[model samples]
Target: MGIPLDKAALVGLFLQTLFYGVFLTLYWLTLFVLLKKTGIQRQLLIPVGTLLLFIATAHLILEFVRALEAFVFQVNTLGADAYYSNLASPLALASLALYITQTILADGVVVWRCYMIHNRRLLVAILGCIVLLIYGTSGYYVVWSFSRTHPLGNTYISITIFYTLTMLISVSCTTLIAWRIYRTHRFIPKGLATFLPVFIVVVESGALYATSVLALLVATLTGSNAQYIMLTVIPPIVGITFCLIVLQVHFHVGGSPSEHSAKPRGILLRERGVRDTDFSNQPITVHITEETEIVQSDMMRGKNSQLDSEGVFQV
Candidate 1:
């Protein structure tokens, strides 16, 4: 039989596949909900977002095919050499390539966030570039190792180093961003106050990914196939982390105190000798957007109320 179904490697991969499906579901569902709020039929359906979805879908498809071939077709029909060769096949290599792409893109998103939070600082950008080059080089080495006769024996050390470096970059950059946000805003909501040591980012993003990468790296170093089990789920974790950043930014709270007051209220303001603008003539979307923010102002029949709180109409 080609690698027994009950083997630790197979069982670990199976568990990972199930978790990957869960995270993949979360990614698309959250993406759709937030993007739908942007209106305009399909607003902000950007290239990076679309590419992430494509990569995730393609990865799942490849996993399904491989799983079927192993557990169904080759369950009792292959020897050891064929089993190992099957793993290093072209499709398997392509799958690893897909994972590398996903990691690069996810890391790019994290770096972009640091750039944005730091207001596009040149030094930060340069540092980010160097980190990415190192990460990419290491990632490529890991893939190349897969073609070797004994991939894990040849590459575990490098894999450990790669994930270690990855976790370091992720932790350091994320902490910097969170610290800056704290210095600027003075406080993040207590509800989102999880500033974990090495796995969390601003707004509690990316902890799962960082932690999983750490676990995978540790497993690799310990000379176990547990790393492969974690690999199946890491892509989806990366995508989910990227998606969480977008979701947090999208649902940011905005409005005045009275806008969020317990009492439902509206306002109208006018000035004497001023032309009355017909806002109703504007586009429906514009009007809808304008009305999204509740106005808290007082009406003045014949006097300027720009600073005065008299003759207020609460509608």
Candidate 2:
């Protein structure tokens, strides 16, 4: 049983590597699409993408090291119990930390999006901050538990529960963002040919990470060995979900009729200083008067997804 468990871990690690390859490819394509479509804003985006790749690569390398430790080092020395025992080795600690960091960072990005989607309302922002604080605090304990060189009693289980909470925060914020975006998109009068795809991409991307986390949460709660496999797969998937959201938004919005028609269905970018991520944090409103119409139109749009305030079509 011990030998087979070790083998299962090894095989899981191998599959994780293969998954990494697929995601790495998507990351490059995502980066390229982001740069090409994002215009000057690529400065902020490139750094985020680079960080994602760096974290993802670190996860793979650290996991590979853990695999070696479990299979080669332990087998050659202390036998299979060493493989099963939760040794607080450097490689394991680093791997654990990397996974935690990836999940937290990805959640932060989604929370940021949620903040913006809610029009940067102080209430939403405050709630997001609270979520981050809780997530960070819980994650600290998780790492602290790992520092003991092994999970003491139910320490690992506690860590798993905390991790689930962190993921739930993501799903909650994602739901809010999606609902907000959907409500806003209901207003585009014509040539919505663009926003629908963006909407689908956003929803699907959110679903991607949401589903992964849900599965992760379920596996952890069920005490299945498959939890290890899910953990290995999640970091890259989170990174991919985020990049795809940014990439798809930029791709569809960048190539919209705004380029050819010179007026992009009345949607005009709001003047906000230094837009973060793909777009500004304010919803783009159309060039119109009539407060009633403006209010109605505003309900149908989101910030930073239109031409510059100067009326220049970016890219």
Candidate 3:
């Protein structure tokens, strides 16, 4: 007899599903906030945000299908009867289609953003061609797998390859951009730098959705309830936790003032005539002192001076 899902496993699965839904919603909301806050050109974010929105929608659809499947098959196993009854459902097929579309869109967005940021036009074109090839090949494999009732093997391999490539490209681009920005800017604002790593992790981890799909496929193939529970519960939890850690790190790093800013001398200088040359650039010290009846030789020394109320020489 096959191992059946027990009460604890059922509860665990329900909680995992709930968390997945909540996280997906949060991801969308966060993306919107970033879109509003980012100084990067609006055109760039549009494609990225659209891709994220589509992926979130796909996950929601997948969750719905899983919930419906659980309700019918788990609650009324005898009534459902068919081993692959859920597979036959229109909603299930629609969810699968959406998932595939989401994968393509996600990969495309990553490649496009990377190429755009790097100004690598030729490489971008090459990546675009690669995406098309992978997507087409994956679609063919998926169709063949479904037709032959062997989706588990073929779909898993194709999706994994696609996701791995996407993750590699995105991470490389993000790290390069961050490093370049750090090098070029004298003082990167705490807020911006803090926010960047979090953004990268969140976006890159979107590929975890593909991992979850592969896990589900494996569980289905093996008919293992334990495998299903493990696959469904672990990846999202780990991925989202990493995202939250990145966010927390950003908030702390960006929120706190630098040691240089916190110095006693810096505090005193703030009140003096000295002021930051450019608020956005490195802070430079400017000393203002009083000078009366400036000496001709000193004046000829090419040093600039300004007179103050006190009749004293100041430079």
Which prediction has the highest TM-score against the true structure?
A: 2
lDDT tens readout by residue for model 2, 1-315: 222455556666777777777778777887776566545447655677678789989999887777766667777786653664563666766777888888777777667667655656788778878877876777667777767755567676666666667767776876776566555554443425654665566668777887877877876677766667777888778767766666556556456534535743443333244222223566844444454375456654544433212111121
Colliding residue pairs in candidate 3: none
The root-mean-square deviation over C-alpha atoms between each candidate and the true structure, in angstroms, is 12.8, 8.4, 13.6
Native-referenced Cα lDDT, model 3: 0.45
Number of the candidate with higher TM-score, 2 or 3? 2
lDDT of 2 at 87: 38
lDDT of 3 by residue, 52-165 (tens): 455545555565456556656565763322433434355545544555555455556545544543444577558666765776577546544664444575566774564455
lDDT of 2 at 47: 72
Q: Which stretches of candidate 3 lie over 4 Å from their true place?
A: 1-21, 24-51, 58-62, 73-89, 128-132, 147-315
Off by over 4 Å in 1: 1-13, 33-45, 79-87, 148-154, 187-203, 252-315
Q: After superposition, how far is residue 108 of candidate 2 from its true place, in Å?
A: 0.7
Give the 10-residue window scoring lowest on summed lDDT in candidate 3: 306-315
**In model 2, which regions exceed 4 Å deviation?**
1-4, 36-40, 149-157, 253-263, 266-315
Cα displacement (angstroms), candidate 2, residue 227, comes to: 0.7
